[model samples]
Target: MQGENTSVERGIFIVLEGTDRSGKTLQSHNIYEYLTAKGRKCVKINFPDRSTSLGKTLDGYLKKSIKLAPEVSHLLFTANRWELHDYIKTNLQNGVDVVCDRYSFSGIAYSSGAIKLDFEWCKSREEGLISPDVVIFLDVNLGLSSGRSGFGGEIYENIQDQSNVYKAYQKFTNYSFWHSVNASQDPNVSL
Candidate 1:
C-alpha cells in the first residue's frame, strides 16, 4: 500500500485588533490589498461579520434593538468567529495568508472589559480556535479614538469602556507574538 500524503502547508494568520475607530479596518484592508496586488493569495475577514446568524444577533445587540446579557452577547461575538473558523483554517492550509480585522483578541478584550469575568474565563471559550501567528494591535488613546467619526453608537463604544478595553489589551501584551502599534499618530507612520 502506498503511504498517504498528509503534509499540511503552514500559512500565516495575521490579526489586526483595536478599539472602535482605531483604523483597524482601514489598515487591514490596506494590507490585504497590498498583498493581493503583490500576487499573494490572501484572505481578509472581519469579525461580527453581520451576515452570519450569530453576527446578525450581535448586530441587533449593538444597535440596541435587542438586549442580551453581557455574557450572552460576548458568546455571540465569539460564536460569530467560530462560524468562520473552518474557512480560515482551510484558507491557511491552502497557503493563503489569513488577514483578520477584530478577531479573538477583540472578543476577549471587549467582553472582559464590559463584564467582571476573569481573562482566563474569556479565553477558555476560545481554547480550540486557531491562534493568529501575528497580532498587530493598534493602540489609540480612548479620548482620541472616541473623537473619531462614528463613535458611541454601540454598547461598548464609549470612552470608559474603551479605556477598560485598553487596559485589558495591555494585559494581553504579555502573550507571545503580539505587536502593538501606537495609532495615536498617523497610520502612514504607525504601520
Candidate 2:
C-alpha cells in the first residue's frame, strides 16, 4: 500500500540486526503486522534459517551439540545466509517486502568476536550476497538484556559474548544505511 504522495517503487528489503535478546523477534513480528494491516505485501524471514541443511548444522552448533573450528563455524553461518540468497532476491523482484531477522551483520559480528576469526575474514564469505535496502539495528545494553526472557537459550546468549557482539555491532554505525534504534525502552514506546 502506498500513501497518496509516497511510494515503494519496488520491493523493499528491511533487515533487523541486533545482539542476542534485543527483542528483535517481537519487534519484527509487530512490524510485519503493522505493514500487513496497512496492506503492504511482506514476508518475514530469519537467518540461520534452521530449515536448510546448513542451518540445521548451525543450529546444532549453537545448541553446543556440534563442534567446529572458529573459522568453519563462522563460514557455516555465512553459508546459511547464502542458502536463502535466491529466495530473498526473488521476493524483492516480485515486489514483496522482506522483513529479515539477522543477516551477514550477525555472521560477522558473532564470528569475529572470537579471537581466532578475523572481522574481514568473516566478511569475505558473504561477498556478492544480496544487501538489504535498510538495516535497523536494535541497540541495547547487555545489562538491560540480562533481564529479558529467553536470554540463555543458545551458546552466545551470555552477557560476555553479547557484550562483544555489541562492540562488533557498533562498527556498522559508520555506514549511512545502518540505523541504530535504542531498544532499551519499552517495546511499545514508538509503536
Candidate 3:
C-alpha cells in the first residue's frame, strides 16, 4: 500500500460555444448531469463568471449599464478568463471534469465578430489558457433564435451582432476537436 500511486487522472475540459439563444447554458448543464449520472466527478463553470470583479465589469458592459471601448472590453473579457485559469486547472488536475457554458472562443467571436477586431488578435489573448479537450458549438439559425425568448436582452443579442458572431464561430469549425450540433431542435431531445 505504501508504494501505490494515489494520483488521480486529470479530468477533461469541455466547452460549449454558440450565439445567443443557442442553448449553451442548457447543454452545459445537461452534459454535467450526464457525466454525474454516469458516476463521473464533474463541475460546471461559466465564463465571465460574473461574481468576480472583472466579470462584474463585463456584466455592466453587457447590460448597457456601463460603456467600454471595443479593445478595452475585449481585454477585460480575456482577463476574466485568466482570473479563473488556476481554478479550472486545479479542478481538472484533481480529476473533476469541467463542463463550461462558454469559454475563450466567445471572446474571439464576440470581439471580432461584433466589433470587427482582428480575429488573430482576439485569439492571441487565449494562447496560454487551458485548452478544451472538446468544444461543442450549438449551431442555431439566427432567424429561429430571434423567435426564442430573451433574444435581445443584451448588447450583443441583436440579430446583426449575432450573425457576425455566428460567422466568426464558423472560422473555428475546422478544428478537429470542435463539434457543431443543430440547436434548432426542441429542448426535449437529447444532444
- For residues 50-129, write the lDDT of model 1, one tens digit per residue: 99878888888988899988778778888888899999999998889998999988988888886656787888888889
Ranking by lDDT: 3, 1, 2
> How well is each residue in 48-99 modelled by candidate 2, as lDDT tens digits?
8999989889999999899898888988888888888888898888788899
On TM-score, who's better, 1 or 3?
3
Instruction: Candidate 3: list runs displaced more than 4 Å.
Output: none
User: Model 1, which residues run further than 4 Å from truth?
Assistant: 1-8, 188-190
Worst 10 residues of 3 by lDDT: 182-191
Per model, state how many residue pairs clash.
Answer: 0, 0, 0
Write down the worst ten-residue block by lDDT for model 2. 1-10
CA shift of 16, model 2, Å: 0.4
- In candidate 2, how many Å is residue 131 off? 0.9
| Cα deviation of 110, candidate 2, in Å | 0.3
Best-fitting candidate, scored by lDDT: 3
Cα lDDT for residue 76, candidate 2? 84
Candidate order, TM-score descending: 3, 1, 2
